[model samples]
Target: MEIKLVPVRPEDKGTLINLYQLYEHDFSRFTNRDIDKNGRYEVNIDFYWEGDERWNPFYIEVSGTIAGFLVVLFENMDIDPDPTHVIYDFMILQKYRRTGIGRAAAIKAFKMYNADWAVTQMENNTPAISFWRNVIKSFKEDNFTERYRPERKKYIQELSTKT
Candidate 1:
């Protein structure tokens, strides 16, 4: 299947918002998040299209169908810079998980920006940790480092894009 990362535009906010709700729903099991009176989870995706050059938002398309979403952040974008990128959020819809679509989308996202990368997962999210470990290993061999940040309760996987 052809996997494509279609940039999310301002007009496409609603689509991204809808997809984001599903993404958050998946996290409900691993988080203490509760729906509010609006019956919707709070989503903070407006920054992507708010003219922040550091944020990249895209819809992951598989065989011409919307399968997921990815948000990449240029690390330290507002500060003294370094060659780094961060996979802020990545999710493949429930129906597309384990179908290789997620892997394809991940690799594509990695290749999109020419810089070192950082991917983090919540400490309790073992599945995400495993998925990212496998994907990063496949893409970078043994060149990446995985470390746990106790204060943040997350595992961070860092790798260089340079060959």
Candidate 2:
């Protein structure tokens, strides 16, 4: 399958909503809690499109369908107090995963940014943790650290390796 990264537009709001729902649903399955309220979720998504400086959302198109979404957030590092970009969220539809699409999209995003990038996955989401571990392992410099958040019961994996 061909993967394309496209700039998200206002017209793509519905598609973005669907993608967000997919994430919320999967996340709920792992955490056993609803992270989003019905109407409130849409509001948050709309806010992102309404010029949220922190988040830059993009559409991941596979073939002709909008398979998922990715958000690159400009954030300050907790350890070093330096500005950096983080892959805030990334999700591909269940049917479209494990076909190299996710890795391809990641590589594309890395090339486009040409800087240190980071991604965090929930600890219960073993597949995602494993996927990220493999990706980091393949790199020459796996500059990453995992921090456990007792309050959230999740491990935040931060990667700064970019080749």
Against the unseen true structure, what C-alpha lDDT does each candidate score? 0.90, 0.72
Q: In lDDT terms, which candidate is top?
A: 1
Provide the global lDDT of candidate 1 against the true structure.
0.90
Residues 21-123 of candidate 1 have per-residue lDDT tens digits of: 9989999899979887999999877777777888888999988899999998887778847747999989899899998888889999898777889999999
Q: Output the TM-score of candidate 2.
A: 0.78
**Per-prediction TM-score:** 0.95, 0.78
What TM-score does candidate 1 reach? 0.95
RMSD of each: 1.1, 3.6
**lDDT at position 84, candidate 2:** 74
Clashing pairs in 2: none
